[model samples]
Target: MKYDDFMGEVQHRLELPDTGRAVRATRAVLQSLGERLQAGEAEDLAASLPMEVDYYLESADSGQRFDYDEFVGKVADRANVDRSDAAYYAKAVFGLVSELVSAGEIEQVRAQLPDDYEDLFALIDAEEVEE
Candidate 1:
């Protein structure tokens, strides 16, 4: 997806008031997700994303072995939102990412995370099931 489309999708998904909030959610979720993935896997995933958001994954300190709760906490802190909103933001962002990224890369990312992180991809899975 292009940068504008990516940002617009994020804004629509999160129902945010403006581009600024969408940027925050995208940065927070992508950065937090990147940290959880290995450097190579993160880079591979980053390769498929838009220019504006890809660096969030490319520049993360990968191999940080935080669980899903900590993952949500980090996103909440980074996005300056509550934990609940952070989780929602993550689901929304990941849902969009699943479309832009290839299936093999998605499997790589899924393999890196534990089952608890499945909630993050709730929308992705649901859409797949319907199709």
Candidate 2:
């Protein structure tokens, strides 16, 4: 997706008031996800995202170990939202990302994450995941 399209969709999905908030939320989720994934895996996922957001993922330190609770903590801190809102926003972002990337890529991501992260994809009705 193009940068505008990606930001607009993220703003709409998260019901954020403005572009800046959407940017923060998107970065929070992608950066936290990047920290969880290994370098190559994070790169593979970032390859399909818009350049603006891809940097958030690709730039993370990578391979930082943390559970879902800590993941929520990280996102909450980065986005300046409560833990519940962090999970909600993160889920919406992941849903959108799923639409943009291939199913194999999504599967690879899911495979790397433990079952604790499954709920984060609950919003993903990825009809477009084939590509």
**Worst ten in a row by lDDT for model 2:** 122-131
What RMSD, rounded to one decimal, does every model reach?
0.7, 2.6
In terms of lDDT, model 1 sits at 0.93
Measured by lDDT, the strongest candidate is 1
lDDT of 2 by residue, 64-112 (tens): 9898889989999999999999999889998999889988999999989
Clashing pairs in 1: none
- By TM-score, the best candidate is 1
What TM-score does model 2 achieve against the real structure?
A: 0.93
Model 1, 44-103: lDDT tens digits are 998989887899998999999999999999999999999999999999998889898888
List lDDT for all candidates, in order: 0.93, 0.91
